[model samples]
Target: MESVVGNGCFRLVREMANIQGRDVFVADLYVTPTWLDPGNTDPLLHFPKDADQKDALIIPLWIPGHFLLSVMRPLQKEIFFLDSLYFRRADGFSSQAYRELLRGLAQQIVAGAWTEKTALDLKDVPKQTHGNDCGVFMIMYAWYFAMDACFDFGVDDMCLLRRWWCIVLLENFGLEGYGRKFAHFTDEGKATLRDNVPPVFRITRKRKLESPMVSEDLIQYPSLQPV
Candidate 1:
């Protein structure tokens, strides 16, 4: 942090602090299809720099009107699937290209999470009866699979689940002061380069976290040279 005294990165320090021991790469919703797009310039999915210790990789996929969840445990050579409507995916959606996309995702994950690949084992999960609850099932699957939690939810829990989600969303977004910006730098009275703090303060940020962050930690984020 001293190297970046007045530059930005204080929040990176805090978020890094929060995730120090936790490890899971939760891909953005609906990103599974991009793996098969050879013409797509997007880079292959990567594990976090500190992904030496990972629990699982969670991905939510939307095929046609339905959404399902896929969790990859690369170390175990296992890819688990949870679909609300367990029937084979509808016509065009079940094309060979789509199957290849999922396989590509599994291959990338296994290669990144581990060193080699074998015949990955596909595991089935409890299915939802309602057609519209695929979104909800997907979310829960990600939650459970990430934590290695059990499949305790079923159709009887649907009503309570929907209402619970409603309350959670409202409480998350409807309340005032719901989202607070990171204020460590501001608290340090060093919000900008113009408000520079002493080197000790910046260096102390790393020291307090008890984690040595080398230049590689911020490879994508070039550190600003101290003026």
Candidate 2:
């Protein structure tokens, strides 16, 4: 499979795009159910660029809706950007155990190692409450974006199985926990968390850690608007 230039996530999407020869959208949050229509473009093709990087323009589709639904919006709030699944090295604050485990899990999924039931078992790894619907849509949107972007991966590369494992590992290290602990209502994390559970084997109100990120600021990328 192809790897994007800047980060693995970017590379993964780009590679898919290169192979598929299509556009990609990376929504920062969950788009409302009716948000994608003739007046709007696909939610996955827009992304903003950093001064040091050069990627195709990506738009942020911020969903404007009801409070409960908005809470379910993935890109409707601020968020921390970390593609922990494709960590390039062993250094940094990441836990080696979690990294190794997630990498193996991703590999297994790519190899078609698990079943839908197993994948669903790990689906709610982080056990979240606020972003339940948003999380589901985020994963769906990411995969949709990746697929439409036309990268090199197959059903396995960025499949739900791989994504589930990614969330499992993410929760193990409390990465999402910290975000939840201090996140605000409009914050992707809701301003603070009082619970932490295993991503793969837990049941609680909070959304799973491996779930797609929900942040409004990330949606600020201007290219996300319908063209």
Return the TM-score for candidate 1, rounded to 2 decimals: 0.54
Task: Residues 65-88, candidate 2: write the lDDT tens digits.
Answer: 211101011222111111212123
Best by lDDT: 1
Q: Look at candidate 1 and tell me the lDDT of residue 187.
A: 31
Model 1 poorest ten-residue lDDT run: 1-10
Q: With candidate 1 superimposed using the best TM-score fit, by how many Å does residue 159's alpha carbon deviate from the native?
A: 2.4
- In candidate 1, what are the lDDT values of residues 129-157, reduced to their tens digit? 55466666666666666656566887767
Q: Rate the local accuracy (lDDT) of all candidates.
A: 0.49, 0.31
How well does candidate 2 score on lDDT at residue 24? 43
- TM per candidate: 0.54, 0.21
For candidate 2, the lDDT comes to: 0.31
